[model samples]
Target: MNMMGSLVALLVALIWKPDFEEWRLGWDIKLFARIFSGIVISGMAFAVIVWCVDANGPVFVSMFRPVRLVVVVIVASLILQEPIYSGSIIGTVILVGGLYLVLWAKKKEMKSMSNPVETNRTDRNVV
Candidate 1:
């Protein structure tokens, strides 16, 4: 996904060379700064994702992504003075419920994987 985003960003830069002189910043400098910042932040995000996936399984780590929507709502309400509506509350509740279901399923899947089945045919092959 990061790769795709980077590719699209590059395409946009090539197609739309905006005039930065109007904004008091040099085009080359601003372009490089944007690219560099994107790379750095994306790298850090990917690193954290890899670490989380290593420490906790992918399902557990992925369950947290939905919380970003809640954060967005909070930030919008505080920073942009946007009103929180019933739809936002319903969405938050649904997201939380979905995350809970995923977590419960992961626990059940892990438990089933941990227990081995006992077989009666233990006769022929010995290591």
Candidate 2:
């Protein structure tokens, strides 16, 4: 899936930007460092997400998707000194609330499935 998406993106980029000079890379350490680290980080993140989905199912992994936004916001604010706006705080609050509800519901469902309720029924015989 990842390879297919990457190939499609490369094809689109090639078509959109037909100038080969635009794709030229200079002998710069920073450019190479950024490209290499991005590839490594993306690969590691993909592997971890795949493993998590396999182990805990998609629902469990999906809940963290929004949480990643919150994490990115916080990390950027701290590391990059980016400003945190009121909207970000409000959105984070909403995301956390929704995540809590989902987790609670999932736990309740698992608990019910583990201890299923017994059902009673009566049968009538023909006279």
Candidate 3:
């Protein structure tokens, strides 16, 4: 389904531009290497995400999005020499904080589930 969506987008782009050069990949080794690396990395990431969703559920897997964003920002800044704006830093901090909150909540919920409290009741009709 994802591949189908990508194919549809590619078709639309081709139709809208109708220029073969825009759709063509020339014989550039750097371009080829980048495309290859991107495809391999994205494919492996997608596979891992699917496995995580199956094993830990969607909420657990969804946390990876912010982690991925943070990683990308770090990598782009360090490796690609990209500039990091103040907004990016603030957003990253917020994302990390939210992730921590979710994780803490999950831990607390799991703890509660494992050790449910028992109530001693004196009156059955008490509300």
Q: Give per-model TM-scores.
A: 0.65, 0.68, 0.68
Clashing pairs for model 3 are none
List residue ranges in candidate 2 displaced over 4 A: 1-23, 120-127
**Evaluation by lDDT, superior candidate among 2 and 3:** 2
Model 1 scores a C-alpha lDDT of 0.86
lDDT of 2 by residue, 45-119 (tens): 889989998987788888988998999999999999999999999999999999999989988998999998988
Among these predictions, the greatest lDDT belongs to 2
Model 1 stretches astray by more than 4 angstroms: 2-36, 117-127
TM-score, structure 3 vs. true = 0.68
Clashing pairs in 1: none
Specify the poorest-scoring 10-residue window by lDDT in model 2. Answer: 118-127
What lDDT does each candidate get? 0.86, 0.91, 0.88
Estimate the overall C-alpha local distance difference test score of candidate 3.
0.88
RMSD of 1: 5.6
Total backbone clashes of candidate 3, pairs 3 or more residues apart or in separate chains: 0
